[model samples]
Every structure is written in structure tokens, then in C-alpha cells.
Target: MTPKLKEDAQRLVIYIGESDRWRGKPLYAAILETLKAEGLAGATVIRGVAGFGAHSHIHTAAILRLSEDLPLIIHVIDTPEKIEHALELVRPMVREGLITLEDVRVVRYTHRYLNPLPADRLVEEVMTREVETLSPEMTVAAAWQKMLETLIKAMPVVDNSGQVLGMVTDEDLLERAGLQQRLSVAERLDKPLLDEEIARLRQSPLRVADVMSKPPITAQAREPLGLAAMRMAKHGIKRLPVLNDQGQLMGVLSRVDILRLLSEKPAMKMTAPLGATQTVRDVMTPVIPAVQQDDELPEIVEKLLESGTHRVIVLDGFGKAIGLISDSDVVARIQPSQRRGVIAALFGDALAPSSSVTAAELMSPGVLTARPETSLVQAARMMMNPKRKWLVVVDEQDKPLGLVDRHILLRALTAG
Candidate 1:
């Protein structure tokens, strides 16, 4: 049963014809859904027995034939701000109806148990207090140095007053730091783009102001950590710049920060609610050692056992992945012996795959993969079905870029 609102709380009463609909959904249902989705405290939908509108057309639910135009009232009792926001959203939905607001003190508002701790834990609790901020005038080369030294994926581009103006990431630096500018001095490296040449190119004069992703979407430190996690995932960011009410940078919240916290929480569960808007890249293990398709079974098995990967990518001569061999395939193939099942435990499903019978003989015909940008939620769903233990993170050409497993989903859930 739905909980009752306390006596004397602000209530938004929306009256619309039962037949009214916005975007094909019944107006009452649409509004109620919106209110609930928006996390409003409580809402109720009432149907009138008899009523007449501005058109003077009488409507009644007393009989089935005339029920079409019955008066439908949606009662939403919450904070004033929520009611006002919901009112604006309902305005365009009810093309022709009456809406009213009243001050009713809610003495019995309920459903408290549903939320573990709404707005109880602020972002400041889990945010990294020490932030490595970037200045608009800081050279891309300088920023790259910091990124590599700290191994932090992103940093906020802030003004002298500490107000965030933009955000810069390693990818932003890699692309704009002149690394792709053909060795800067050597039009095209007659040799290869070596570490030295790349370093020289990175020393170019491009500034953070020129390369950062500007007009960054930010979050307030006082808000719930879940809100910050949602913003990060929704925007496909690994971390968010924590800001004060004055819009000044305060700290940074990262997937790792949240993950470490969540992983330590004894109450944390894989099903814990969280925003999975963060991409696979946030948690993916970027480097998974690979083996050729023809690599022998014993050698591959040994590698899978030691590498701690359930499946390994089988690459062709050109380094293009052709297939995958998993520990499951090995378990299914090997003539069972009395020896303990150590390999099975090591792989947990190998965690990254083949042996003769050869990698070609044991591999799953087509390797399942996910892109770096795939949302964690979507990736979780993809990884969950078909009993897949893990997914190979791939690039545009289906080149193996990394690997993501069930742990990724767990981290995403807890980060919220």
C-alpha cells in the first residue's frame, strides 16, 4: 500500500480529464511516473465520480459509457520546490485542465525505508580532497606530465578563483599535444614515432585552454554522492570536479574513489542501485596479454592459469583477434583426471582463452566485445546474459583494447 502524506504539507493537486494524455500516455500516469522518477516524497491519483469542465460537459465514472471523461486528480505532496517543478512539467501535459496548489502540513509522509540514505552521504564524504587542477594557461605538455605522474585520468580546468571552466583528460592531451603532429620537427618520422619523438611533440605550446572539454557539467559537494555518480556515468566521465555552492572547485570524485569505498562496504551488493552511465573504460583492465591462434594448448593453458584471465584473445598474424579460448572450453575438453581443479578456480569462468586440441580448436568462434564508450549499465546487461564471464573491450577495428568483468558491474553499483 502507498504511504500517506503527513497532515499539513505542501500539496500540488492537478485535475485533468481522465481521457487526457501527454505523449500518448494517460496524463495522470505520466505525471505520477514523473513525480516518482523525480524522487518526490509521495503522490496519489484520485478519480472523480462526477465533474464538469470549463466546457460545461458533464463527466462521471458512475457508469462505464461516460467514464471516459471522469475527473482525474493527481495529488503530489512534497517540498515546495518539487511541487513547483512538477507543476511546470504537468502544465504542458494537461492541454485543458485545472491545477491547484495548497499548503497542507504532511504529518504522516512515509516510505522512508525504501531509501537507505537519501542525501545523507554527501559527495564531500567520498570526494578526494586534494585536487590537481589545471590552469587555462598551463601547457598541454605540463598537464601530460602530471597526468602520467599521478596516473589520474582527468583534471579540472579552473580559473584563478578556482571556478571550473572546463575539464581535461589524458585522451585530450594525447590528441592535442602534437603527438599526432608528425614528430613536430620530422614532418613524418622516417623511422617510427618513438618515445623520444613523442616526448618532443608533447612539448609543443598547446595550452589546456585550447584542448580541454569546456563548459563542464559539474556537481555540488553538499549533494548526495549518488547524484555525483549519476552525473559521471551519464556524461561518461571517470571523475567529476567537486564544487562548492559558489561554483568554486573543492575536490574531485572518481570511480576509483567510489569503488574503493564501496568495495569496503560490507553492505555493498552487486544489485545495489547505482547509475551505470560511466563507460566500460572507467573500470576496464586496459592491458590483457594476447596469444596467437595457433598457440599450443598446453602453453595457452599455462598462460591462462598464470594470467588470471578466464579467456584469452586469439589473434591472427596481423594482431587482429580471430577468436577466444576460455577455461570453460578447457574444462569441457580435457580428459578429466583426478588432479584438483586449480585451473578452473584460477580462470573463474580463465578470467581472460585455447589449446590443442590448439587455440583454434578450443576457441569460441566469435569473440564478444564492448567498446570503450559503452555505458557500464549496458555493458553489465550485455555481460550478464549468455553466461558471459567477461567481455573484451575493443576499439573501432575490433582490436582488443581491454577487458571488463563482473567486478566492473559491482564497482559501478557501489560507486552510486
Candidate 2:
């Protein structure tokens, strides 16, 4: 049995004439550039032998001299959101042309793997160009709004000479917005009350300079990517502003870039060895906090802040773990794939024009669980999954007992 097409995809078709120009440049070239700039995997352009549309003019390549305005089709395939982005980018450039979108299933696809750049690659070599920067003078409210729209977690703040001044992250913005006081997602709230709170937070009269981390941690363009990673991990920073010898911002690099680098390096997946382990009960955190499904959102946030833990488990009447929620689940504007769909529902009350909601609506549904009697190695193995972040430790009767965090797996790997 071999692998076949088993994934959903989308294809965008753009119908344009060969002579079409955007900003005085060839339309086809402009479209290709846009797709590449947006980080799409790939695209193809097909030239038609003969075609006529809209104006009903006969434009054919039958004769080389009369090949003017020959029909061309640009095909791009990618995720739905990315496809939408491509369309938005091309819409203004394409003044006269037909653009259509359709669903497609990816079948057999093949490509030669490109070798990953050496680990010692310079910071500038891996940093993304066209980085966005925040002005220290920008309002905290405006900054959060911008970050929300762009799906960026952090941004570098710069001075007038393009000098890196500081860095601001979502966490910084949220704390300044006074969200910590209302972090509990399991609180009862009237629609208007939630709206007022959200609105107030957004309208805070604070500037980026007031909350951003001053004298930002940065990477020199000449430094190795590994050094940047070490600095990032040591400081717990998500991204670093790349600066040139002139002390001006060059670009930006982050953990995501490192992940991409590892993905390209096939030889990098080294195994982590470990010693024998006994039972899940021996390693599990026996004392775990529990929240009910129907609890209010505010109460949930309060519990999370007070506990200082990454996440809290949700339990049903019988004390069995039903679901779970974390701080990211409540704060992230866009829910990550790793989180349950209910994460978005967490904001349902906040976004709804008029409504009230509970913790059940905001939790990651159907929690991952492990039995206390299960082998510690097996539990650690389960936690090794990159996407499975947290799990509930349960008793013999499926009652809530403890939690198995990602940290537990790291500890297990070193137990040998």
C-alpha cells in the first residue's frame, strides 16, 4: 500500500493577456513575484495557443507576428487562507483579467528536497526580508490591533534612524491592557459587560514606549543562526531584530525560522535516549487543578493567573477529565491548529454582539488522558508528540488525578 492523494487544497486561476501590464511591468511576472513574496510553495503559468475573451478579439499565436495579446493563465495552489492572501495581493495589480478560485485535492505530488543551509548560516542569510517594525510612539491599542490583523506575536520597535529601540510582544500588550485582572474565561458575563471591557482595553492611552522591552535583544547580521537561537531560548524571546553594522534594522528571525531550518535538514532528527520508567503514578503531578465545563470565563482566567501553571484541566460531574484550557487559548486572536476548535469559541462571548458564555464554550474539547498505572515510559512517549501539549492523569476509574506536562517528557528523556 503506497501513499496517495489524501489532502484538501485550493487552486487559483488567473486569466490575463500576455501584454497586460501592472505598474509598467508584465502581469505574469508581477503575479509570480507576488506569490513568491507571500511565501507560497509553488505556482505555474500556462500559455494558451489561441484564445479570445471579453472584447471578442482574435489573439492567436498561430503566426508569430500576430501573437500579440495571447491568452495566459496563472495557476497557484496553497492553503485557503494563503490563497485568499494571493488574491488580495493580485486584485489591485490585475486591472483587466478574469480571476477564479476552485477547490482541489492534492494527489501525488513530488519535489526534490533542498538541503538545509549549514547550522552556521549567518543571521542575515536566514532572516526574512520586508520585516515589519513598530514605532515607539504608536499607541498600545493600535499596536495590538495591528498584531491581531497580521497574526504576528511580536514586533521590533524602532527609532527614527531605523535603529532598533525595543521589542513588544502580545504578552506585553495584554498585561498593559489590564487583561490579567479578567483572565478567567469561566466567568459569567453579560454581552455588554464583555464588550465594554474589551473596548476599554483597546482604548488605553498608553504608547509602545511605555510597555515595550527597552534596549531590545537583537542579532547581528554577521552572527550565526545557532547563536541567535541560543540567545532566544536563554532569554525566552520569540524573535530577534536583525541589525547591520550600521546599527540599523536589517530583518527579523524567530523560533519559527529555526523550525523551518530543522525541517529542511533531514539528518537533524536525533533521538533522545532515556532510562526505564515505572508507572505514570510515579511521575504524574498528583495535585492538579480542576475546572468544570459550565464554569464562567472570568473564573477560569483567575484560576490560570493564580496557579501560574500553563493550563488547567476541565472535569465533568464524575471527576473525569473532559477538556482543558490554557492562557494562550484565551489570549491568542487566532487559534493555532494545535489547540481545539473550542479555543475560538472562547472568544465567542467577547465577539458576539450580545451574549453570555461559559467555560465549556472555551475549552479544548475531549482532553488527552493517561492512566496512573500506565508505564512512565509510555506516558512520556505519548507526550513526545509535538502537537499533544498537555494531558490529564487519571485514576483507575477514569477520575481526574493529575496532569502530564511537556516538561515531564523532558525529565523522562534524561532519566537514563
Candidate 3:
């Protein structure tokens, strides 16, 4: 029998505007603070690479043509009562913009931080150390074995200099294999193919360098959870490589980490509770999957698939996450149409040509982001108010950090 999905009347709304006149950072900070003050779960901001408004003016980040016409999207997610409370707060700021609300189902809900004792508190207290790593020169076989031994989906790739170059994960490895299979089929076909095409497939090797994602995304250990969530959503990734002050790989964070944190917390009941004082860092997953940028994509994809994770963190020469590669990202690089169709359905958009594109081609860069110190309340407000399900978390340097999903917050509330 299909179990009935425990339904909650939690509603969220997102806000967008076309002017850069406002202080984006401060606005985000304020939103987070406001949500926390009101006892909401979280909020988030999503930056757009390009956008159009009622005026039909194209907005972008080109310096010479610096289009102030760009739009900003703000998301907030919370209980029905909290949603109303948050809307009242942002009403004054709703000038020359768009605000839309959508209904969302809460799969889980809880308070991420229950105990305040020093011994039982802080992310540093619960985060895992002694993380696994990978090297560019490592063979696909060796990397695959490591993933099996460690029971992890991704690994950080480092060099002799202790610098992170990229990341490799099971997803990346799988994508490479799929690519190889496609190449092999094409080669076997009797149809006359270009010499370049034949040579590319013939020479393709399942090496770490061939599969690893370059310019990996990373985060500092001390960063907050709010920022990390935002980064994950912005990049459409599920993991963030953690680094130390020396730029050495410290560990990795994953969506599962966030979910686990939510699982450990108390579930929220129907009665409205008092405001929460916790931050994202208080609940972020300290252990993560990392890999070198130069690792073979096929090997990484294999590990990721085996580990049952959707994303991997890529590190640079300094052992810092510089880029991220998710199953969605890798799939987009290979199969654009399927990815596009899925994304379009998720966003409630028509299955048009624009919707049928890959994450690499469709994803917006220079994301609207938040820092670790940001409040969960504000994060929730951003996510709920804008009705956005995902938020990217970043450090003060605006590097990719982690992600916060509406479902994650809701789970915490339910668990509370």
C-alpha cells in the first residue's frame, strides 16, 4: 500500500528584482536575521546569469555593457504561519520586483541544534576528520578500490605539492563509461565517420585526468551551513570540499550530511515554536567526498555510483575545493536532452527547447550567495519567501560551500 505523505501546509515565496541598487549581501543578511527572529526555518538567494523583465531588457554581468537590468531571485521556506509572518516583513521592500508563492510538501522537519552545551554543540564537534583523498596519477582501478574501501562516493584529488587539482566521483566515472560506450558504438557503425572522431574514441583512456572535474568547488572548515547550502544549490552539486587555512584538504560535506543533521534533531510539531538561534555551520556535514581535478571522469563516476552519491568535490593544487561535479553536471555534459526535460518539469516550465539543456549550459554563474555566519532563519525566509527549494552556500570569498534544500529544513522541523 502506498503510504500517505504526511502533508504540512508549509508555503514559500520567492522575490526577484532587476536593479543592483540594493546591497545584495546586506539584504541577504537582513533576510536571514528576520527569519530567525520570527522563528522560521530558512531562506536563500539565487543569482541569475541573465534575465528579462516586463520591460524585456536583457540583464547580464558584462562589465563594459554592465547591464543593471539583471534580476535577483530570493527564496524562503517555512510553515504556513511563519510564511505569513515573513511576508509582512518583506512587504516594505517589494518595490519594482516580482514576488510569487508556491505550495511545497515537507518530507521532514526538525530543529538542527537542540542542545546548547559546549560539548554537544558546534559543527567542529560533530564533523568527521581523516577524510579520504585521490591523486591525478592514480589509476581508475586504484581510485575505484579506495572508494570501495572507504565506502565513499567521491574523493579529493591532490598532487605532490599537496594542492587540489580537481575532484573525481562515481558519477564522473559513470559518465565517462557511458561516453566510452557511445564512442565504441559509433566506431563500430559502418557509417563513414570523420578521422578525428575515430581517433578521439580510440585513444580515450579511463585515466584519472580524463575523468576528474577541473576547477573544483571548495569551502573553509569554519564556514556556516547557510553559505554551504547556497553553494550546493547554485552549482546543482551535493558536496563541498573542505579546506584548511593552508589550503590543504580538511574533509568534505554532502547533502547526506545535512540530512543526517536534520535526522538527529527534534521534530517540529503543529504548534508554532519559538525562534531558533542556530546557524548552518551548527548543522553542516563535516565529512565529504573529494577528488583531484585530473582524475579520470569514468573512474570517479563509477565510485560515485557505487557510493550512492550524486556529487563530488574537486580540489586544486592547494588541496582546496575549486569546483564541483554532480551526477547532474556529468549527465548534462553527455546527455543534454534528458537532463533538460527533468529540470523543466521540476521548475514547472513547459518542455521547450530552452528547458531541454544541460546543467553546464543552463546553470547560472556568479551566483547570489550567503556566508557561513548567516542565520538559518534568514536562509529559510529567503528560500520560503521566494518559494525556491535550493540555496547555495559560500564563504566570505564567495567560493562554493554547500547547499540548503527546502526538504532539508522541513525534515528538521518534522523531526523537532
Candidate 4:
């Protein structure tokens, strides 16, 4: 969404000849640039095929006079103050043309007419101030515990002087400390197995500096939020450490923070046209990973493995989503003896044997769903529930159409 212009506005029309020049550049081009540089609401340049000027000389795009100076009209509409400012700046450039002004009504304005992300919004406005930072001297064991307690997947490693040294993530711990699963999955492990994993970390001499990724990518607190979002997307990172002008750590900005900005005022009235508003269908991944409701446990595991995702949507006979089967669900719902084999199969150690058990018996029923036309903000609010990571986009018949997860939603907002 974008801010709308007042209904009472002014339209400035400048009539000029294509042959006219301003400092070796086209007069209309120079004027248009000046108006744009002045921050005018909007402008358009339309070249006429055939027309005549005040001199009464005819100009046409006919074969004989194809290079004749065609009439170009520069159209602009904005607030009264902006339009007046533009007229004052550009009027002097049109030495031999006409300029007209008239009152016009602004029927609508949307992101289609402007930038989707507000350029005026600063990074500090949305960044999390009370960031859970890690010290470079902290041991891997200590850092891991901090991440688990804070539920933060990524944390910036800083020095005693508050200078950012590097970044440590859950993936780094998993790779460097021989962890068997992600932080989320590890949290659900039994006490004995969890203690065994912790003991392995305690035995290692690795510190945050040893495992953290150095030369950290960061954003300035004063930079535009849009630019920071772009930096995250360009680097394919989940979050960035925000720093002040002094080069000291200030805060952190994550994908979740950017997504929350989209729905900051969800209840605010949306005045944009229907086509201008983004919907689930605009960003959802159409290729959904799914399995039949009656699929055997082995088949479900195969689908999960093939999809390279933690969860798979379960569909009924009519291809309607009814439930979901996640890796955690498999470990929690299945018999104790089958858990090891299922986990091993998911890691491609071996394929689980087909059993009479069906997906319907293992899957968590009543999945979250959204329609193709559901607004992006609405989708965000619905996904605010901590347990709802993915939203199954469905048709009117409740059949699966696509999938919308946190990453996809974040990508859409960042793209703005």
C-alpha cells in the first residue's frame, strides 16, 4: 500500500516541441527530470504524431517529414504546493511552448503508482533493540544454550567494546559441534539424549569465534528499511546486525520483523484497488509437497524426503488438504522402536518399509488454510500463531492450491 494524494489536486500540462533543446538535452526531458528531482507526485511525457505550434507551422510523422519536431506534452499531477513548485522550476525551460494548470480529482493511488516499501521508513524504526548478542569469547556450549533459551536462530557475535565480530547461527552449531538436529528439533529431544548432545559440545574447545562466520554483513541503523531488507535478500541471510554510525552493534533486524511491518496496521482501511493489493496466490509456491490421506507411513516419509521439507500436506480423495505430517510428528506419534528407523530414513540412511499405518493416523489434522485472494497482511496475522508455520492455500472447495510459509512471506515483503 501507498499514501494517497488529496482529491483536490492540480494537473500541470506543458506543451513543447521535440526539437527544443535545453543545455544540449531535449527540453521536455530536462523539464521532466527537474520535476522528478523535485519530488513531484507523478508525470508522463506523451509525444504527438502530428501537430502544429504557435508559429502555425505543421509537424507530422509522415514519410516525407518523419524527423519533424513532433509535439511532446509533459503531464504532471500532484498537490498544489508540489505542482506550483514544479511549474516554477520547469516553466523557464519551455521558451516557446505552452503551460496549463487545472484542478483535478484524485480517484485513487496505490503501490502500483509508487514504491511499495515506504522510502521514509528507517531501519531503526523496525529493528529489535533488545537483541540477544553473543560474545566472541563465549564457548560453543554457552552460545548454544543462549540460543536455545532465547529461541533466536541467529545471533551476532560481538567483542567487549560492542564491535560486531561475526555471526553465529544454529546451522553453525549443528555443523561444528556434531549436533544431530536443528535447534527446534533438538529442544524436543529426551533429557538423556539432550544431555549427551550437550556433553559433546562441552568436550569441544570451540568458541564462538571459532565457529562464527566472520566479516559479518550488517545494516546501518539510519538506512532505509527497504535497503536493509534488500541486503538480507541479496545475501540470502535470515537476519542482519544493525550498527550505529560509530560502527558499534545497535540492534538486529530479521525476516519476521519485516513481515510484521506489513501488517502493522492490519485494521487500517485499504483504499487501493483490488489488483494493487497483494494476495496469497501472488507469492505462494504453487508446487505443493503433499501425500494422500491413506498413504502408508513409509510413503509419507518418502514424500517428506523427496520434498526436502520438514512437513508434507496430507490430502483427501478430492485433493483437498486435511492434515499435515511433520518430521516431529513422525517421531512423536510412532512407536518408540520405529522412531529411529523413521529418523534414519528421513536422513537417507535407509528407506522405511511400507506398513499398514496410514498418513491419516499420523498426521495432525485441521491444517491452516488461506484463499488465493486473501490479502498478504491477513495471511501474516493468521500465521502469527507460533505453531502455524505454513499456510496451505486452497481453492473454494478447500483443495490444495499452493503453500505459504515464513520464508515465502518474508521474500515477498522484502521484494517490495
- Top candidate on TM-score is 4
User: What TM value does model 3 have?
Assistant: 0.35
lDDT of 2 by residue, 11-45 (tens): 89999999998888999998998888777757899
Tens digits of per-residue lDDT for model 3, 1-416: 11112356455555555453335654545666767676666666777777787677777877775646556677776667667778888766565566677778877444434322122233333345667888887766566546645667677788877677788886676476322222212223232332333345345456677689989887677766555655655676767777777877777766555545644444455433333445555444444555556655444454445544455556555554556565455434545334434333322243322322322232222233456665555566565444454555667655556655555554333233
Give lDDT: candidate 1, residue 96.
92
lDDT of 1 by residue, 217-297 (tens): 887999987677666666666778888989999998776665555434443254532332356776788777567878776
Question: Each model's TM-score?
Answer: 0.42, 0.46, 0.35, 0.71
Q: lDDT of candidate 2? A: 0.67
TM-score of 4: 0.71
Estimate the Cα RMSD of every predicted model relative to the unseen true structure.
16.3, 23.5, 22.5, 11.5
Summed backbone clashes in each candidate are: 30, 13, 122, 0
Q: Candidates 2 and 3: which is better by lDDT?
A: 2
Worst 10 residues of 2 by lDDT: 347-356
Judge candidate 4 at residue 396 and give its lDDT. Answer: 86
CA lDDT of each candidate? Answer: 0.67, 0.67, 0.55, 0.81
> What clash count does candidate 1 reach?
30
